[model samples]
Target: MTGLPMEFRAEGLPDRVTIYEVGPRDGLQNEKTVVPVETKALLVSRLAAAGLTAVESTSFVHPTWVPQLADAEDLLTRLDRAPGVRYPVLVPNERGLDRAMAHGVTEIAIFGSATETFARRNLNRSLDASIEMFTPVVTRATEAGIRVRAYLSMCFGDPWEGPVPVEQVVRTGVRLLDLGCAELSLGDTIGAGTPGHVTTLLTGFAAAGVGPERLAVHFHDTYGQALVNTLAALRAGVTVVDASAGGIGGCPYARSATGNLATEDLVWMLNGLGIATGVDLGALVTTSVWLAGELGRPSPSRVVQALSKEQEPDHAQA
Candidate 1:
């Protein structure tokens, strides 16, 4: 596998899959303990050094809403931004966008929901109203020459609303794209998605004239189906995936949510399949292990756990 082209072609999959690292932002936001700003900055630097090209650095939400990321501006300012790496921050509304713009952010993300229940719970608005809220944010970001990525939550299934209709998801996603979002990240917020469900949703999007090139898949491993669903998306021609370091993230408002798909785990599978992600799995595992220490717990990522276990004997021998 060594020396294989970083952009090798794979049947039924893109030549490369862009792994959007969401660890510094999403992963840390939901932690019970507050991670120091210095540590968060170090994590972002380490991730970029490990060959992650696009990392979601932080969110610009109010401190009262997400106290964990209250230092978003400070963190961004402290980062030693790696050349060729893109750091996109999450902006919930126009106000968040204003804050991001002040820091000269070049890329940002806006979030919406496919189900009304989750929309109300997460964004404090109805489904339609949430889209209305993000329209101006997306518009302003685009006008400022910033690339905007939109995240549509609960695309697969909603805990309170049960199974979500595929049509509804497509409608919300299309609206975001129409509002000037460069890409849409369909989120399986509750991790209730299966391979079949993923295929169905992608197919629905296709029918709605939304191709995979403009879409990314974000999955959680609550039921251990994230990777499987990811495979289904790959088969459907999606080349972008959103994952977190150490698989440490969940929606604070969604009671049934769990940690996201680990970047190490996703890279391990992609490496085995000869897929190019430009990510160093061993380095990512090390980063996750260090982050787990910061959180005072073992990483939830299977790849990180197994790799750390494998290194124990070598350390003991030394």
Candidate 2:
């Protein structure tokens, strides 16, 4: 059996948190080897079996952008929607949304940039033009009764722009929320944020009348600050966190960004806090261990590495 963390209830943290699993989509997006649609289907099934409710399944972006997820439609067809799980797909534009809608997707996520530099570099447009682009996408999705999530990358820092201002991020995020997005996920695309920076940013959002309930955080581990920053966000009442299995994936457009906070690692910390994540830690570790084998690398998650070590050697190798 995999090991578990000791329980210690933490005050001011949510009793239960929604772990937005990004392993299938984000984890494989940056993979050099395109995972077979069947393998991705199995990964999604395993994550659902491990109790992650909101799994980011795939993206409808053009194949030129994310070739690894080119078979998003096929993956969805194979899975046929896991029971008790919500599989959200990324839709970069109206065309992508059309593809997602064709596949009967009920939830979609749109990614944006907080910094002008990243906006220009990633979207090939100015920040304002990108917002203009998202307006129609969000409006159409919401009108169709599809839940839309907006992602504000470079919310913390950008490799080209350096540290992004808290005010700018809030303003950009508020604009996205105004476009009818149900939730705005702030991303430290370069992982350069500190805990104090995280607290101040959340405070900025609060002052602007955006509460933690409508917010989520996506952090990379470049500076090894993702976990601490997450703790800060949780203290600030942000309950929805985005993580990848086996600590895989980073911003494909941003070279400096590293792997996201690992799901097993986050679950271990939450388990110790006596917080209910509805995730079976052993099952998750086993899944990630199996995933590591498929990737031809060991899992980068410390929890997965440690627990895998304690398991029978014949099982998922540590």
Candidate 3:
């Protein structure tokens, strides 16, 4: 199959895709080492420069729980934000949203769970109670002219309950979107989804009158189906996909959850498909390699691992 690569546009896929970069927040959150605030700031800048429009900068979860992002305020303060880029942050509750508001945050995300077990385990509340909590958060954020995104975890499967129903996911997701969220990111928290499952779920959403334009898919690569499932999603008309640089983060609460669909891998596939992502693949690979050095682990991204080797001797090991 090859000399120099060629481009081919597949049928039924969006011509341009918006990558929701989650590496800075989700990727580093699970790391044992507390990445220096400066390093975090640099990572955000590099990702923006690499042309990701939406880079999730950090989370404002309570320090006692997610200690790694305790320096959220500092990270936000230090970032010299790139123009035309949106650096969104995760605000778990009203207090977190208050802190974000103080920092002049323009975009924020609130994550909820599709299953009752995950709602209790991850959010410390029942599914309905969590929605009760997000109601005011979304209301106030919208009133302040801020944009809010909702994350519905355990969309495909739950560690404790297992095999979540599509209708249940639809109901939970609609609740979040109904609360004034601009979009809803469906999370396969355990990476338990297949291509057929993806089609069925998107169908469920469509039946509920939630079109693909207002939906995003966030898949974990635990079962090696992330990319395939993503293809299924795109075919189902999803233009927004979530990925983390170097594939560094996983669900800290869900033991079996693994790294996200790596940004480099997603970019490579999207590039080969002739879809416009506005990302400089070479620059993104370089940034991810540098981040791997800071984390003291090699990237799980196949593209980064291959390209960095050809970049330079030091970069390959970085």
Residue-by-residue lDDT tens digits, candidate 3, 7-124: 7889999999999999989888888889999999999999999999999999999988889999999999999988999999999999999999999999999999999998898899
lDDT (10s digit) by residue, model 2, range 49-125: 89999999999989998899999989989885668899999998899999999989999999999999898988899
Worst 10-residue lDDT window for candidate 1 reads 1-10
lDDT of 2 at 232: 97
Look at candidate 3 and tell me the lDDT of residue 306.
Answer: 85
Tens-digit lDDT track of model 1 for 127-152: 88988898889888888899999999
Ranking by TM-score: 2, 3, 1
Weakest lDDT window of 10 consecutive positions for candidate 2 = 309-318
Show where candidate 3 strays beyond 4 Å.
1-5, 312-318
The clash numbers for all candidates, in the given order, read 0, 0, 0
How much is 35 displaced in model 1, in angstroms? 0.6
Candidates ranked, most accurate by lDDT first: 3, 2, 1
TM-score, one value per model? 0.95, 0.97, 0.97
Q: Which candidate is the best by lDDT?
A: 3
Error of 2 at 266 (Å): 0.2
TM-score of 3: 0.97
Candidate 2 differs from the real structure by a C-alpha RMSD in angstroms, to one decimal, of 2.3
